[model samples]
Target: MDNLTHGLLGLAIGALRRPDGQRAPAPGQGPRLDGPGLRWTSPTDRAVLFGCVLAAELPDLDGFLPAADPVLQALQTHRGLTHALVFAPVWALCATGIARLIYRRARSRPVFSYSLASVLFAHLLTDLWTGWGTRILLPISDQRYSLDWAAVIDPFFTLPLLAGALWALARKRSWRRSLLVGLTIAAAYMGFRVGSREILVRRVERAYPAATRVEVFPALLSALSWRYAAILPEGYSLGRVSIFGPVEPVRTQDLPAELPERAADNPTVAEALVWARVPHVSIQEREGGVLEVRVADLRYNMGGEPTLQFVVLVGPQGETLEARLERGGTIGEVYRRWKDDRRGALPAEGGAG
Candidate 1:
């Protein structure tokens, strides 16, 4: 989701995890193993509120790393290996050490390390759902793990949490209770999403009895919603259709083809080619280059926005190519479905045989 929701969740986690107190627990007393520390359970103080926000938001700074993303060049510039899982503990420790030294002057308060850790952990968990995934084991290994479930900007996922946090802030009441309510709502929304996908799948199957394969997901970044694409024969040329609130659903055909090289033949393709200006737009035989190419309406996607998008194979000569795209949650799945359909469309049929 967005920062606001994460901030609230971070705050909630902070509040619940800490101990109930207006005064700091003795240094040796330490917080309960599962309890929040100092500012977490204290009567609502403006500084504590601010600290909660900071604790939640600060860790996301690493979302912009150089080697972190493929299609999105910006991540490569920021949010690097420092944000990985293995690094999370080390990062928190370093941060706590720094805060311990720097904020020792605060006579009546404990350090801010607890809150910092809360925000960092929240950031990592939020990233676990997006398409790009997170590298929790950074220094150990640069592998990425993601649920491939939630979109980057799910409203259902974001709003409830934000509302709960706001309510907590405004009432000066139970931040813990409010946090639980909001997170519960967010969890329910996730359930709704899975149910909604099943609904879409059943509906699409009923509509297109011939659909050999079908896949559905909410539009990338669209919370608690979904989009669908199906593969059949030529009658239904690769198309994208949106399912907004269950009203008869609308469809749009004209999905972009995958082959960037094919654009050389169809000037129409050239006219629409985005990122063509980029140096690496040419075809490359990547690891999983065994597929067709197609362009998706990735404008709504976080990083891969362009008018003239490119795809892998399905070029003029039907060449094998690589996917140089950084995918958001939704459209990437569409591309995968489209590629699956083209397995039978090679220059010579039954090539797989």
Candidate 2:
């Protein structure tokens, strides 16, 4: 999920229940809603809300932390230790403490800490829906887990969450009920998407009896549509699934499962095989008869230029040389440059010049 969605989810969680555990206001202490916007009924509500929102975004702090290299950053940085379930409570404690100092509200520290921890846990849960797996149980094990149920950015998911948060931000009397209903609706929608993906995967598996692996990825903005790939011994096939329309024919591309004997030892190839959910490998020749072995993760393609890529340079005699893992389009215009470089260097007759 995106940062804005996380913040709104935090807002909804914060408004789920007040610190006092009263769903309704006191007999004569009804909340005021006549102002420009809804105001927190008490200092404690404001503090907890703020703390939850802050804790929701704290896991992304690793993006700002300096890393020795991109490999380290990809494997052990953002969405690494910070997003782990083990770290959520500790972070919630720190965040709640800061909120206490800021609001100085009359609330039990333990209660506030628990509420904030729940909000942080929500962040981890949301990330698990996307293809970019989160290291939820990190330290215990470095494995990343994902359901591949929702796209990183899904308006269908975010809109309801935002609506609930906004309602809570505006009207105080029934705020708790509003957020609970919103959260339930969002969860249901996610479940629907998961079910849809499962159907598509089954269809693909049935169509390709020889498929060794099959994975469905979420579309950019639509829950009704999905893209999937099935890995076969000789190559792989790609297709799009529409929940509302007839199934389209699958597109097959032939790519050997085995790389050149020389590239078998390349570290870059090893890294990408482990990292990519749908790995597509190709061998190309560059200048000076250098063998450029490329592996791309099709999960992030989204029908556009490829993003995540691992490249290795092999000598003329098939000896492994230097290798690199690169990403395109992350920083804008850089992707275009990478694309243009590849096109311009293409050998007209046969192989590299």
Candidate 3:
């Protein structure tokens, strides 16, 4: 999910924490201080809001970490250690310490710490709801988990949360009620998406009885449209299905289930395979005995072409010449390096087995 949506959720959490009878003042107007030594007792003080927003977005801070490979950086680092459940308390403690220093008399340490930890947990849970995988249990296991209920960037999910946050920030009373309504709507929306995906999955399964496995992913922009991969004995079929339009797949393509040793053995390719859920390999013979191997995850496909892909250029002697990650491009742009006459061709059955 995007940072803006995360921040809005943080704002909503902060609003919920606001103490009774405490009215939120206009922007730039500080919270009303009470008690001896001018202690800031407001639970919805600046420190609390800062802590909430920070905790909400802190998991994504792993993106700053450096890595040798772009694919590893994106797949392993961005949502890796920081997003783990075990690290949530550690992150909360660190955030609380910072908030305490910034606002010395904001509130009780336990209150702030608990609120921060809750927000952090919410952030992780929200990430899990999206199609993009999240490594919730890092030290225990590196396996990425996802519900595939919503797209990473969904306005339908974010708008309600945003409206609640804005209402809470702008209104002096009944803010929590508004936030609750917004959260309820968002939860119901996710339920609808989950139910719709299940219906689509069942329909695909019934349509392709021979399929051994059927996986459905939420498409961008709308929940009604989904991308599915049905694994069969010979190969896998990838397609798009519209829940409202028809129970069957609107667009479908069959792809062979083969991974070449030369491509898979490459260090970069190996790292990407770890993260790819439904991989599609395209090997094209280019000029001067060069091989352009493109490995893409069907889960990230848009308009029939994959946006998240890894490309490896191999020399005639099977030596890796170039290895890089490609993101967000049309089919032509992604395969522009290959000649127009060339097409993706798999090697002999056992040649690259």
Q: List TM-scores for all candidates, in order.
A: 0.53, 0.78, 0.79
lDDT score for candidate 3 against the true structure? 0.69
**Where in model 2 is the C-alpha error above 4 Å?**
18-40, 106-120, 256-269, 283-293, 302-307, 310-353
Candidate 1 yields a Cα-based lDDT of 0.48
Best by TM-score: 3
lDDT head-to-head 1 vs 3, winner:
3
Over 1-353, each residue of candidate 3 has an lDDT whose tens digit, in order, gives 88887877775676555452345546555543321223234533667667777778777878889976666677777888888888888777776777777878766565466556545645887888777778988889979999888878899988998888778557535556677678778778888988898898898898789999888898767657787888777666666677875544333445633656766576666767766677677778789977777777778865445677788786766677877787855657645522211222222222111
Tens-digit lDDT string for candidate 1 (1-353): 46776676666655554443434567765443224432333333333444555656665665554431233332332334645655555544444444445444332242255555554656777766654456656667645555445676677678888888777667544555676688788778877766666776787777778867654544544554454555555322122333464423232233333444443444322322432211113333434433343443332221122223335343335432333453433667646543543232212111000
Model 2 pairs whose backbones collide? none
State, as a TM-score between 0 and 1, how close model 3 is to the true structure: 0.79
Local error of candidate 1 at residue 76 (angstroms): 4.6
Candidate 1, run of 10 with poorest lDDT: 344-353
Candidate order by decreasing TM-score = 3, 2, 1
Of the candidates numbered 1 and 2, which has the greater TM-score value?
2
